[model samples]
Target: MSAIASSTRVLVIGGGPAGATASTLLARNGFDVTLIEKEIFPRYHIGETLLVSVQPIINLLGAREKADAMQFQKKAGVLWQWGGEEWTFDWTKLNCDFTSSFHVKRERFDEMLLRHAQSQGVKVHEGVSISEIHFKGDRPVSADWHEEGSGEAGRIEFDYLIDTSGRAGIMANKYLKSRRFLKAFQNVAVWAYWKGGKRPETGFEGPLTLVSVPDGWIWYIPIEEDVHSVGLVCHSEAFKESKTKESVEELYQRNLAASPLIADLLKPADKVSAMYVERDYSYSSDRLAGPGYFLSGDAGCFIDPLLSSGVHLAMHSGTMAAACLASVMRGEVSEERATRFYHKCYRAHFVRWAVMVSTFYDVNNKKETAFWRAQTLSKEDLQGAEWTDLKPAFSTLMSGLIDMRDAQDSDLLSQTKSRLDTVLQQIRDNHPAPNDRFYRNGEEKFDWGRRPENAIDGLYCTYEPKLGLVDTGPTERAFAAVESSPAAE
Candidate 1:
C-alpha cells in the first residue's frame, strides 16, 4: 500500500447534527475519523425540535443522560390551526413508538453531540472549509481546505468521505438538477429565540401549537427552560406588493400584528437577537452518493419545516450513512453494495416526506385566495420532477423494507378504503360514533354535526385510516428503479 493510503482516514465535512452523528458512530465502530466544520461551536441553527427516535441514538452514544440534564422542553406532538380552529394530536400516534419528543437549544444540543463524538476518539476541527476535492482510484485521495478564522491552508487524504454540510456545501451539488416544486411553498421564516413564551410541561399531552393563517403559519417551538423558538412562515405573495424595506424586526412585528395569537405572545416578550429570515422552504437532490463519498441530512435533501422534521431526518440519515459506509470499510460488503445501501436509505427517507409536502398544499378548504388554491389544486405548480421518482422509493420504506427514512406509500384510494373499514371497526369497539363534532370556523361559523372525534378528523380520516399505510408492489418497483438507475449501487 502507498504511504498516503496508510495515513488515509475517514474525513467528515460539516459538524452539525448529521456530521457529528456520523463521525461519532464511525469512531465508535473503530475507524479513524476526522470531522472538519466551517462554523465554530455553539452556532445558531433553525431546527430546534427533535423526534423520539433521537433518544435511542443519544443513548447509543452515551449522551442521553447529558442531554436529559440540559435545559430543554419535551413535546407530546404538534398542534395545528386550521379552518380557524385548533387541534392537538400525539406524535406517538404515528408509527414511531415514542411517548414524547424534546425541544432543545441548538447551542447546547449540538455541543453535546460533538463532545460525545470527540470522546469516542473522533478528531474534530472547527472553523475549516473545504476548497476542493481530489478523487483518485475508487475513493477521495485528498481534500484542500482552509481554517476560517486564521485562513490557514491544509490538505488531507481519506479512505472515505462523508458530507453532512447541510445546505451550505451540497456535496451532491454537481449531480444536483434543478428540482422545482409542483406548487412552490414560497414562504419565508423569520425566527429568533425568546426568554419567555409558552412551554408545555415535559411529557405533556399537547404539542407546540401552530397558528395557521390565510397567507402562512406560525410555529412555537419551546427549547431549554423558559426559552421558546418562535417563528412565522408566511406566503411570498403577501410581500410582493409591500413597498417597505423594513428591518427583520419590523417585519416580524408586522407579521405578529397580523395574528392575534402571536401578538398576544410577543406583547411582553423581548427578542434576544436580531430577527433573521429564510426563504425557499422546499428543494430536492436525487443523487446523494457518488463513488467513495456519501451525503446525509440537508446535504442529501430537505423538505418543508412545517413538520419540524429537519433535525430528525438529519440525525437519522447520518446514522444510516455511517452504518452503510462502515459496512464497506469493514470488508463486510463491496463498495458497490454500500453505494446501493446509501441510495436506498436516502431515497426511502425523503420521498414520502416530499409527497406529504405535496399533500399539504393540495387542501382546498380553509384556504383563502389564489396562492393557497394554486398551491394545492394545480399540478402545473409542481416544481421538481426528480422527486416524482421518489414516490416509489418512499413507498418501499413505508412497507418496512427500509428504516432509514420514515415514509408510507399507500395510494389515496387504498388508504381511504382501509380507513373507512378501520373507523367502522373502531366505532364498534368503542361504542361511540367514530367521530362526534363537525364544524368549520371562518368569517362565519358553520356547524356540520356533533360527535366526540376531533374537528380535523371529521374532514380527514384519523390515523388508522389516513396517510400512513405501506404499499407492497409499487414500492418495490420504485426501489428497483432506484437501485437499477445509474444513481444507485
Candidate 2:
C-alpha cells in the first residue's frame, strides 16, 4: 500500500457502529471522510450483546479503552437450554486470545463510537438524512441530504460511498433494490427491560442465557448487575396469528409465563421499560458493492441474532469497507478487485452465519412444531444436502475465531485446525462425554478457508502493517506506511 491522497473524499451514511468504524479508519488513513446520521447521538436502539471477535476490530479502531471504560457487563460465554439438554459455550475453553465480550446499552455504546469517529477528524453531521443518492451511470457520485427540523439541506459529492444506514438499506432498498428477506428466518422479536432480575447461579458469570420454548426462544441478557434486558423471538406467522387474539404485551407475558425458567428469573423483577416489537426477520442484498459504492452492516445483510452477531458483523463490514476503499484510493489495488474482495468476504461471513443459525434451529427439540419445522432444513430443501456441510465454518464462527484477515484462502484453515485440535484433545483427555456444543463442534476439521469459493480474484484480506488486500503468492509488500494528513492528526 501507498499513501492515500488527502483529497480523496469518502461519504459514510448512518452513524451507527458500522458507519462510525468505517469513518474512523478511513480518516486515520488520511481520507477526507464525512459521516451523516438520521438520528441524534445516544438514540435508543436494540441488539445490545456483543461477541469476542469485536475486540480485535475495536483495537484496530483504537477504542478499546473507551469501550472498557463504559463498564458494560462482561460476557464470558452463553448458556443454552435446548434440545432437552443444557450446556454452556464458554469462550475460555476456546483457543483464542480474547476470551470475553460485553452486553451494552446500545445508546451509550453507539454514541461512544460515533464521538470517537468525530475525534478522529471525521466530519460528522447528526440528524441529517440522505434523501436520495445521485448516480452517474452505475456509480454513486453524490447524495441529497436534509437536516431534521433545521430546514437545512444540501448535496454531498464524494469519490466513494459507504452505506452503513442499517436496516434502512438506503442503497439496497431505495436505490439498488436488491434486498431479499430470508423466508426461513421470518421472525418477530418482542423485548423489554427489567429491574432487579435474578441472576442465574450456573454457567459463566455475566453469561447470555438462551432458553428454548415450544414455539420460540427467550434471551436473558445482563445489561447491568440489576438491570436486565429480556426478549422473546417467535415465528412471524405465529406472532401474527396470536396478535389477533391479544396485544403484543399480552402475548409476550403469555410466553414468559409458559417458560418456567425465564418466568422464575423475573419473578421478583419489575418491568422498567415499554414493550418494543421489531420484525426480526433476516435479509441480505444480492450485491454488497459496486462501481464506487459499498454497502456495510445491515445495509448489506442481517442474520438471525441467535449468536449475538449484529455488532460484530457491523464493525467487521465497516473495517472491510474502509480497507477496500483505502486500498483502491492508494492505488494499491484495482477498484474491481477491492470491491469484489469486500463483496465476497462480507457475503460469505453472512451466509456462514445464516447457515449456522438455520441448522441450530433444525436440531432443536421443537423441530416437529410448525414454528420450527418451517425454518428447519429438510433433505429436499437443497438437493437433499445436510446442514453439516459447513459445520467447520459454523464452529469457527460460533467460537468468534474468524476475522477479516482470515476472509480468504491463507493460513486460516491451518491455524484453526491446530487450535481446534488442541481444544478437542483437551476435551477427550478430560471429560469422556463432553456435552458442550463448542467441544462437540471442535472435533470437526476446519475446511471452509480451503474452499475455492472464498478467494476473490485470487486476493485475500491481510494486515501485516495495515489492513488491505493482498495477492496470493510471491509478490512485493502490498501495503506500506500511509502518509499522514490533517485528518490523520
- Top model number, TM-score: 2
* Model 2 C-alpha lDDT per residue in residues 422-482, reported as the tens digit of each score: 5444434543442234334334333212222223555555432565655443332221111
Taken over the whole model, the C-alpha lDDT of each candidate is 0.59, 0.74
Residue-wise C-alpha lDDT for candidate 1, range 77-178, written one tens digit per residue? 665554455445555544443446778778778988988898998888877788777767545667887876776777888878888888864456643443
TM per prediction: 0.73, 0.83
Q: What is the C-alpha RMSD, rounded to one decimal, of candidate 1?
A: 12.1
**Could you list the CA RMSD of all candidates, in the order they appear?**
12.1, 8.9
In model 2, the Cα lDDT at residue 112 comes to 91
> Candidate 2's error at 296, in angstroms?
0.5
